[model samples]
Target: MEQLIKELESRARTLRYRIVKMIGPEEKGHLGGSCSIADVVTALYFHKMRHDPKQPKLRTRDRFLLSKGHAALVQYAALAECGYFPLSELDTLKELGSRLQGHPDMMKLPGVEANTGSLGQGLSIASGMAAALKLDGLDSKVYCVVGDGEMAEGQIWEAAMAASFYKLDNLVAILDRNGLQATGRIQERFNTNPVREKWESFGWHVLEIDGHDFAQIIEALDTADQVQGKPVMIIANTVKGKGIPFAEGVASFHNGTMTQEQFARACQLLEAEECEGR
Candidate 1:
């Protein structure tokens, strides 16, 4: 278990590094939210989720949907690292004709479960997928990553009700409660406080955790697997732009570009942290 934690921690760092590179210097991207959920994403793709890069459409594989789709860079990085496609394709991110786009497109990417980025809808889609998998008598689980900011949408609550009403135990939604959204703090923008109570009231099983902690993340996922009659919601408290010192908890970097010097510094900091972990 200790070695597994170390490996997952390293993968999270690598995912953050790739995210920084994908945005690059002076290239606008969803750096903050992407980095915020890097640990959860790493735990999913590299540790918890059952998937296959060689056979992405395998019926038995678990499904992951990034509800906060602007953070598609993290998922893209994972897919590339998992060998779903060539790693070099990452450089073409957001380029015209590239499979990688600002938002996830299932038609373009092999491992992406849905075309997301229109916040609040991915959860609904995941609920539907979970229902279908259940009907098919498949044990495959559906995992969705949602943003606290996106919780303002009525559709999300509706999906929550439906998933619980149907007892979609095979579904798990991880809420990236980073507090900040694209413009500013979520409470200042559209407060979604008391998140845990809200989900619990909706009949979903809830687990709260520090999003960046690998041990808690893995343990929560394992717990979700054991839940029986209700869908699980893991409310992960995280800092926006978690890894980069200057950007952490800063809203401006939500979808902002970095200067050349900032980019170099970001890389340096990430490298130093990675080395220290080893």
Candidate 2:
């Protein structure tokens, strides 16, 4: 178990490295949310999800939707790491004619299941996919990662209600509860406290875990598979701008800029940790 966790941790660091590389000092991106969900995404793509990089559209492959689409860089990093596309293509991120856009585009990318970034809509999309798969009698599961800030959206609950009504047990939504949003703390902005209770009231199974912990993430996902008669919601407590000291828990870094020195320092810090772990 320790060895497995170490491998996942290393993959998370690599994903963070890719994120830093793609969103360089010259470009501003959703660094905080992306970093916050790095471990979760890493566990999914590298350890949990049944996906094939070479055959991204395979019907039997599990579907993953980044409902908090602003954090698409993390997903892109995982995809590139998974060999969905050449890592070199990531250099053109957010550029014109680049498949890697500011938000995920299902039509443009192979691994992206839904066109996201409008926020609050990806859950509904995932519910529909889950329902469709159920109707077709396919056991493929749908994994949707949502932002706690996006929980402010009315549509999320609506989708939550629908998932329960349909008993979409195959649908598992992981909430990135980093406590901070674009402007500031979620409570100061639009508090979505009692997140677990709210999802439970919606008639879904609820689980909470440390989002950055591979062991807990893996366990929660495993438990979700055994849950029946309802969809599962994992409320993951995470630190914003995780893995980088300057950015961790700093709300301003939600979409903050990085000076050349800051960027270099961030890179050095992450690399240093990776080396020490080795």
Candidate 3:
């Protein structure tokens, strides 16, 4: 476990640096939401999730659904780090004919379970998977990462209720509460202030923490597993462009192009963490 944590931290830093490098010239992709959840996704792909990069379709493996598909870059980063494919494939993201589409395509990408970009439906899919695993007597877990903005969709609640009804303890939902949508802040857009209370009311084991902290990510994931009878939700508080200087805590950078200057500055910041786990 200790060695795995060290490796995951290194891969996370490497991913951040590479994401900064991959932005701008290589399509200047969705840096905001991607950077926001890099740590969480890194921890999952590297340490927690039981997935095989070599044989992605292995039936008994755990599943992860990125319901907030805007952050495909984060998945791409983690995928490359975990050896799903060569790191070279990430530059083809969002390009025409590229397997790495703007969102996940399970058929194309190794280890991806859901081809999700649409909001609110991923939780339902994950719930179904969780129930199916239980029915089949499989011990696999299902994890779905959804944005706080996506919580506005009613389907999420329906899925939540269904999961609780079946006592799907194998399912876990994570809400990336960076709090910004395409237009503005989530509060101004839809107002999901009492998020934990809402989830708890619907019958979920909920935990909140700073999403960027590695230790918090580890502890939350562990606790989510030890929990009994109900599914779990980890509400991760994060900055939009977490490691970037100007972009950090700002929403404008959420889905915009990164100028050479901006990209350069971002790379420099990520470089400081290069020797993080050395």
| Number of the top lDDT candidate | 1
- Give candidate 3 regions above 4 Å deviation: 1-7, 25-28
Candidate 3: 10-residue stretch with minimal lDDT: 20-29
User: Could you report the Cα RMSD, in angstroms, for every candidate shown?
Assistant: 0.8, 0.8, 1.8
Candidate 1 stretches with Cα past 4 Å from truth are none
How well does candidate 3 match the true structure in TM-score terms? 0.94
Q: How far is candidate 2 from the true structure (C-alpha RMSD, Å)?
A: 0.8
Write candidate 1's Cα lDDT for 200-278 as tens digits: 9999999999999999999999999999999999999999999988889999999988999999999998888889888
- The residue-level lDDT of candidate 2 at 235 comes to 94
- What TM-scores do the predictions have? 0.98, 0.98, 0.94
- Report the C-alpha lDDT of model 2 over 27-64, residue by residue, as the tens digit: 68789999999999999998889999999999988999
Assess each prediction's global lDDT (C-alpha) against the native: 0.95, 0.93, 0.84
Candidate 2 local accuracy as lDDT? 0.93
Q: At residue 216, what lDDT does model 2 achieve?
A: 99
Evaluate model 2: give its TM-score. Answer: 0.98
Backbone collisions counted per model: 0, 0, 1
